[model samples]
Target: MSFSALPKIGMGTFRLKGNDARDAVKSALSLGYRHIDTAQAYENEAEVGDGIVSSGIPRREIFLTTKVWHDKLRASDLINSLHDSLTRLKTDHVDLALIHWPSPNDEVPMSEYLGALRDAQREGLATHIGISNFTCSQMDQAKDILGDTPIFTNQVEVHPFLNNRKVIEHARQLGIPVTGYMPLAVGKVMEDDTLIRIGAEHNASAAQIALAWTISKGVTPIPSSTRPKHQKDNLDALKIRLSKEEIAAIDQLDRNERIANPEFAPRWD
Candidate 1:
């Protein structure tokens, strides 16, 4: 999919559930968020679906994405899991579907699961397919395994604290875009003096600065917030443009601190 059509900032629905998830998504859509991201592991697809429907937004107007969990990487399991996700999400087909993570301990080969994802696309269960939490090497392996099939985006944890330049560089080299989660560093960015100082100049919040930094790198940042004001603040980030000095200052803050690492995580490149 072209980056222009894909939302530069999406509403992430991780850890949000029940009324909170439903209400947040509804409000986000009302506030002009056309892209919504959720995962099978989040276990709130049903609520998310409810929010989308409740918002009175046509299904075609929203770009919905859901991921398959690591445990369900087997071909049959992957396919069945997506069917269940679709049912819960109340969508005939998601705009994008991803392998949530690489199989734990190599329990399932990359080719097997990726092929199954392709099969899902062929079945029209998802319009596009991609992988998440995959390292540079795994990205290459995925591209090779899928042959001519396009890998849409690699969803991973990216924030000012964990800039993830190497993976971003690699994905850029491949002409693949990235989806950055935790763009605010789980609220840590708000405390950074550098970000605060930069935001002061633009009348923006530190969170907005961090988010703008992510977008400036050409990565989509999916920051979630239940409060309408914060949600609006996140969406407003798309308007904040950072200068080379500010971006370089933020880049110097990377500590390589990863927040989404699991036992199954591929070795970082």
Candidate 2:
């Protein structure tokens, strides 16, 4: 599946909550953002649903996505949790549904969770199925479980500071798209001199440079923002293209510093 057709930029709703979450989604929608990413753990699916409803845009035109939390991986629980997420999002189906994280410690077989996701697709609860925070080996196992069912994308942390080159390359080799979750590194890359220097050439902000870098590397970027200006600024990354030389220069900024590592996250190294 070619990711060229997917929205190169998306709005990520990670830390935003309650009215703030609703307002941010609304603002992003108003600013021409068609893709919105959320999760069960975010605690704002309902608010995001409100934003979609309030936008007055047809549901079909908006590409809505949400994730299933790790703790709710049982086949029955997975189905129920997805239904709850759908109810909260005020949508019958999501464009894409992902296994929030690959909880290796959890005894549930990979087939069990992926099988439930495939069943969700069969039941028309989701249009696409994917795995997040999954290693290459885990992705291989998921592919085996999914069989012919298309695994739309693999969501992972890909930013200038933490360039996941190997994972991205592996997904590319297998024809799976990689969606970069923390393309801005939670505001850390914004202060990097390498990104700043590169951004100067394009007259773009470091955040924009980092986002553009991700896209240039063939990964879709979802940068979360509650501010209107920031939302529009992220969209501007699509307008700025980094040259090969600049791309390599910024690629050197990879320090392997990850911002979203919860104690439960898989070891990427």
Candidate 3:
């Protein structure tokens, strides 16, 4: 998909499950969210699918993304897992499919998994393929493995508190876009004095300021919220333009406090 065709802000469904996941996705769609993010690891694809169907919106209007977990990075496992994801999503194809993370200890070579992901795209299971939680070196290896096939976007934990500069810089250098999950910093941004002050100037909430900062840097922010009001507030960040100074202030908040690093995660750059 063309970069312009992708929405800069999307609704995230990480950790949201069962009726809550379903209701949240439904509410997000009703609140004007055209992009929905979920993953096999989230274990809420069925609920997410139900919510999407219940939105009363045509499937063509939504941009859907799903990921294959780390353990399932083998060629056969990756392909089979995504097919299951498609079934659970109640869609024939996903706009984007990603390798949830690099294989732990390089157990499965990058070529194998990314090659399988490319194969899935050719099979019409995914319109595009990408990776997540990959460090700079891994991004290079992915490009080498995929050759001309594009890496759609790198979805990672990025927020005002953990700016993820290395990953973001490498993605930019490779001409790939980024999707910032946990853009609200898991409710931590709301307690920041600087973000609060910036929000006050824009008459928005601290979370909005954080989301706006992510957007200002050309990164798409998928902020998860179960509340319709909070979902609307997040989408509204698309409209709150931050000045250069405001953006700089938010940039300074990055202390490289990473989140979502599992024991098996690759060594970060």
Candidate 4:
């Protein structure tokens, strides 16, 4: 998908569950968020779908995306799991579908699963196809396997605390836009002294500063919140335009602190 096709800011539904997820999604949509992100592994697709439906917005107006988990990377398994995700989401198709993670230790060849994702696209299950949490090397392999196919975006953790510069740069070189998950660093941004100071300059909250900083770096930041007020606060981040010096200050905050590391995660770029 073209970079212009994707929303610059999205509402993430990662750790949200049940009514929380439902209400958050509904509130986000009601508050004017057009991009809604979830995952099969998040176990909240049903509620997320309910929220979307309850918001009274037409499905066609929403840019919806969901990821197939790493455990289901086997060709048939990936396709089947995505089918299940669509069912839970109460949608016939998603705007984008992604591999949640590369196969642990290369248990499944990139060709098998990526080909299946491409096949899913061909089957009209997802309008766009991409990957999440994939490193530079794995992305290279995927590109080689998928050949000329386009990658919509690479969703990865990219906060000021974990700039993920290498992944961001490599992805840029390959022309895959980066969508940052946990752009607020899971609430840590609220306590950062630099962010706090910057927030004061614009009369914005620290969270907004973090999102603006990430946006200034050409990364789309999807920050999730269970509360309506916080969701609105995140949406307001788009209004913030950081100065070059402010962006550099946030850039200096990166210390290789990755918050989403999992046992099965690939060696990062």
Candidate 5:
């Protein structure tokens, strides 16, 4: 499928485990979510696969994404781990496979691992390949390495609180898509009075307003929910058309907050 064919709303599987993971996937599928995101680091691909099976959604109808963890970015290790991920996912190939995080301390060169990722696409292990948690410089390095090969999307922490404008702009400049992870700011958006007021005006929840705001910025938001109500609510967020003033109001909510930063994360642009 074309990169532009990617769904506007995706169900994320971060921090979701066991029944929480399985049922959430099922609920999301039932609620018309065709994109599902998970990572090898998430340690629930088997459950996610089970949930997909239980949902009775045809595998061809779903856009599934899985990631290779940082520790496994070595070329051979990446290929091996992806094979293992496909085994766990009970699928021959994922719709997209990502480098979960950049090599910690650059122990593994981007060229080695990213080339292997491209090889996987050539081998039909992944329909598309991408990078996650990559900085602007890292993205440039990826471009230098991949050349004509496209990096499908840069999956990064993005929300009203952390608009991630720098990376988003760089990715867009390179003709890459930006997939916003943690689009709700990890529940903080629900407490923001501005979001609540906006939600009230639209008869929606604060979470829905935040999601709608995120989408308005031309980034795809993958908001996860174990509850069917919230899944439906988030899917419904796409229908919301924020006025220019409302978009500006939410734009003011950017505080440079980033939720997915780890000690080994690269220096931001």
Candidate 6:
């Protein structure tokens, strides 16, 4: 349940669906992406698996992750859902498995749902355990349920705009890595003059600069794209280190601009 060696740069497959999703995954692998993120809700685990297969990369070398849908929080149902996902993903085991969301109102108790995830680890379906879209308190509750099992990460939306400073700080204090989804804030980075200026200095795109900023803050950014150049540009950020002043300037752009929020998502206080 610990990810001491999880890749810092990974591909996020949230909105990528169908052939577009498949092509994106294949392109990312071709571009040297060793980590991939997908979920049952994304409806593209199969395509992701296809991309891995097409790339001819051995399954063990890629850090594959998938999630159990929010509706399948019951103990047995969650385990079964992961099994189905594994089948579609064409992999026997996932490097990481996360609870898609903290379904506070799900039929099962939090303990049961988290316990089911632990069971998945015991059965060798998933190697690590984590959660997504969880608020600070919800993460605490999840940890309580998990007990000694290490929670690998808490994947949440974090961009220069919607900083989620409180949650990020809390997670840092607890030593749990925060994986920043939508790190570019859905193209909002393109409009940020400060980030653009910094990118210009580094000869990188604003998207790359924003992604670098995420890693600078010790959070892993999972930016999704189907374009080969864009994906390659994203990976390039890992090599560019932003100066302290640049990091501070980008941090000043925080305006609570969150891009993804479903009606059922937990409200971040």
TM-score of 4: 0.98
Model 5, 121-221: lDDT tens digits are: 99999998999999999999998999998888999999989888888999999988989999988899999999999999999999999999889878999
Candidates' TM-scores?
0.97, 0.97, 0.97, 0.98, 0.98, 0.96
The prediction achieving the highest lDDT against the true structure is 4
Off by over 4 Å in 1: 1-5
Where's the lowest-lDDT run of ten residues in candidate 1? 1-10
Tens-digit lDDT track of model 1 for 171-203: 989877899998887889999999999999999
The pairs that clash in candidate 5 are none
What tens digits encode model 4's per-residue C-alpha lDDT throughout 54-106?
Answer: 99999988999999998899989989998899999999999999999989999
lDDT of 3: 0.91
* TM-score, cand. 1: 0.97
For each candidate in turn, give its C-alpha RMSD to the true structure in angstroms: 1.4, 1.9, 1.3, 1.4, 1.1, 1.6
Clash totals in order? 0, 0, 0, 0, 0, 0
Instruction: In model 5, state the lDDT of residue 49.
Output: 93
TM-score of 5: 0.98
Between candidates 1 and 6, the TM-score winner: 1
Candidate 6's C-alpha runs over 4 A off are 1-3
Q: Which residue segments of model 4 deviate by more than 4 Å? A: 1-4
For residue 120, model 5's alpha carbon misses the true position, in angstroms, by 0.9
Compared with the true structure, all predictions reach lDDT values of 0.92, 0.89, 0.91, 0.92, 0.91, 0.88
Taking the tens digit of each residue's C-alpha lDDT, what string does model 6 give over 11-44?
9988998888889888998889988999999999
How would you encode candidate 2's per-residue C-alpha lDDT over 1-269 as one tens digit per residue? 21324577899999889999999999999999989999999999999999999988788878878999988899999999999999999999998999999865856888899999999988989988898999888888888888888888999999988899999999998788999998998898888998898889899999999999999998999999998999999998899988999999988888888888888887684
